[model samples]
Target chain A: MPNRARFIVQIILLFLITLHARPPAAHEAPPSVRAELPLLTAPAISREGYFTLQLQSLPTVPLVVEYSTDPQFTQVTAQYPWFADFSQMTLSGFPNGQHYFRLAQAGVDGSAPNQVGPVVMVRVQHYPLNLAIGLLCFGGAMFGLLVVMIVRGHWSRSRYE
Target chain B: MSEPISYALPTSLGVALIIAFGILWIFYGWYLGRKNQTHDDFALAGRQVGLALAMATAMATWVTSNTTLVAPQLAYQLGIWGMVGYSFAALGLILFAPLAARIKQLMPMGYTSGDFIRLRFGRAAWWPFIVISLIYALGWLVSLGMAGGILLQALTGLDYHIGMSVILFICVGYTLFGGLRAVIATDFIQTVVIIIGVVVTAWFLIDKVSLASIHQNLSDNHPKLLDLLFPAALMFLFNNIFFGLGEIFHSNVWWSRAQAFRKGIAFKAFLIGGLLWLPIPIVTGFIALAAPQLGIYPPSADMIGPMVTAQVLGKVGAVIVLVVVFSALASSLDSLLAATSDLITRDIYCQFFNPEANDQQLIRWNRLCLIGLGVFTWLLCLPQVATLAALLHFTGAFVASTIFPIVLGLYHPKLSGRTATLAMIAGSTLGLISYFVVGFYVAALTSSVVSMLVCVLGLRWSTTSFRWQQLQESDGC
Candidate 1:
């Protein structure tokens, strides 16, 4: 009786582990073949170091985007899983450099990705910090002058009245 | 592997709520409008608004769709400074408090800001000022109209065009019936709704997503958003301040309110209103910072605020967002429609066509003008021209140019009409060039500086002084 109980417990534990380790059912399905790859487009230049990439003709399968600093993507910087299947993805916080991005059907069962889209590059060039600070100071001075003018004008008018 | 969570509210339910609110407002408008026996009562609310209503209208009208929608969009794009910068807009109201008192004293029977420009600066300055005023008013109207659609679609998955048209029709219906009286009364109630809804949403967001986590996620993923030295955001701060000042100083919307409020209320009411409105953007804006942690990447940036709220709190949250945004939209939209129509009727139609038009004729024209402005705004909104913030800042170039001229013309005796006119033209021209050449962030700042320089030059060069009494124009109606 003791041996039989131990055997049952081991079987239950193995089943639970297997259930937890199985791949999601959606990913197990065979990938759909498409006539044309999704068209990816991005702005030619981004002054703010951020731009949106638009994917047209998106496939039903889950997608992943890989971005790198090089055209050939020799050393991939990051691979982002596209969330919620949105057509437009806005990637921000690039440090004022050229970044290349492309979309692909995420690999299933540890297999290679299928149908990679053409690469698009976005050049990010931020405004000069000095110019930004200069404008800020100019604005501050003008605002101060405005306050002075208003206060003086009001005081003078009140005195006269 | 999970599907995207769909919109929180059902289309039918959202439509039902809008229709219900529409009926309530229109009925109330008609109920209050019965007391409007003359054009004065219709246009200026009989100049008898008490302190409480005065404060409510000031706060509510300034709490525009831009505050609720665009504030979050800015925060999402520009980070912490975005919200803080937006709060700077309350300065427009705070600064306008003293100006409001002066406006009342100067032109106790004034109909619009245009009346002041025309009377104080004469026809030369009046022409450019009128053009700027109309362009800004139309831009604001269209933006409000578009906001109505965007908010509805974001929360309920409703079609943008339908939502936009319904909101416009509803606001026009109420304003046409009740006039400024209805607008103010509803604004008081909408103010309550907006405050409670916004606080509730913010509280829930903070409770669900800890601020530390939000900060951690942003720091790790989008480091620029947390950077204090963000260049574009730094430039945007003062430009936004000038934009707000220009918006309030030159728009007939605020002027009409200043004219409508009872004696001795404009200053304190605006002061209190500005104080109450100072923190709203910060509360609304920080919610967007939680989006990345929740895996909510909105298709468009403008939808970030509602999407995150709805995502966290589900259906109830969607309902709250819908009501709050709808109220914000209506409060400003109705005011803009009524005020812009007043400008057209008093400044353009009556002043140009028939100065002898009686009270009854003026009232009729005012109502017709309301419809006309609504239709024109609808036509502009149909195209979904640009994002709300982009469209709004585009008009900043035109309105900011008028800021210095309006301020100096009001107080400085030596600033002549010709100089003011030249100032507006030069400021607007350079501002537009900067907008295309540099960016929208500098449009208002550049415009205000140019206008100020022109005014300073005029003050030095001029020999004449403006008589203050010229502002007390006789109400022909």
Candidate 2:
């Protein structure tokens, strides 16, 4: 197709997207996760906040993010692809001791629609972003060393001359 | 009869002032630093920009008036998490320090990330990436311009059109003339004024009301807003990182800085710039405390920081607020003009129009393009925009997906031209789909994953085949 025709399609697509985009729900999808897809195995109340949820997306997609909470269930969020950090969150807002949090899954795309799963809740506070943080540091440090080496090589060449 | 006075100059007057300032600044830059003949001089101040100057320029520019003027809505509605989330954007500059060096090494002659996408990704995929990246740059430039007019109207009582036009002319004047050199020099001064304005306002707020008292006020008055892990707040971190990284990774604005800095200036400039940049949002956010009792809702999020400053420090505060906001406007506008000019000159001009344009000829057009771009940008910024984040995110989501392209493309030889191009198109298309189509970060995330999967699957196919002979032929090694 000519570039001009492609441009028109692109603009039309943009306008349609805006018109269809619902205000995103608290989690990736609102209306909750699918009950049928993944079973929430764990019990409703425990000391540390934990929960497991299962559902499929991609019109039949499987990957989903899960989060558990203390009762009062202050915050709940799910990003598509359900990376590790999106699922781990500390419980705030609820009173202390036992709190039950629910779980569900939805496709990031609007296709299959996420359904509410059976709520298997664990109580908890402060889930770590250790893995992601570790990667950031490791990547940053390795790049720093590479930069240093290159700069040093230049410095040494001038010195030798 | 005296109308309710806005300290902002009349729109017409503001326009005149803005253009005059632009002209004045350009000449000053030209007089102090003659024509920068080489890419190094034109892009960076001979790569000798000190940490203080670099840090200031980075901070002042990144925190455009929208950040100061509007972000308070987040603070007002969401509480602490909102401002803190906004401040986290500084991490973009800090973390990017390491990546800059790698970029420099990979494309020593590169003018924009556009060049990288084009070079790494084959023809089938380049146009989508180009459209996405350019859309983002233009969107950002326009948003800042919109903010400039809104700010001028609020503060000085100027007409919106005149205010915006004035602001645009001022930015174009210096950036079009001085290139990056003028932009960087003004950033040094802009930073100082911004710091002074934000800090003094914060100090006064703290003096007026104790931190403990403010805490008590939040707990009493708007308890839910203080809820730490509000679902929106929790989502804010990842969302911001995606938004920030996209700009840092894909936009030539940052890439130009990376290239311009002398061999080592990239790391220092980005790092120090990030650190100094981090504390500012927090300082500005804290000032909202002074008006806890007043129930002072700003005109919009963009109005929050300035309104708070005005409320706490009074008219004198308003003056300082305008200066600080203007500084930010200048820093970003100048950097963008130079970066965009570089893109047009190197990628488009040299490639399509004049493959053999000599260096001198290239420099001349770069200047001309810089002027032309400034005018184009100025013309666009004159319109009003509704949601700053909507505008920002529409562009940001597409750019964010490029992280896969730049990072993976650098080290992974297996990530071939076809794969790179596919990855960019798939990621951006999905991102746009999520933002515009599906209509949320979650959907956007889904699109990014799908795009990523396509790239990964492609990678797996090529990797698993393990054509050792083909690797020998194609690999940079």
- The candidate maximizing DockQ is 1
After superposing candidate 1, which stretches have Cα over 4 Å from the reference?
A1-37, A57-87, A104-116
Could you give the interface RMSD of each candidate, to one decimal?
10.4, 18.5
What tens-digit string does per-residue lDDT give for candidate 2 at B263-301?
Answer: 656777787888888877777766654434433433344
How much is the lDDT of residue B150 in candidate 1? 82
Best by TM-score: 1
Docking class of 1: incorrect
DockQ of each: 0.12, 0.02
Score residue B417 of candidate 1 by CA lDDT: 92
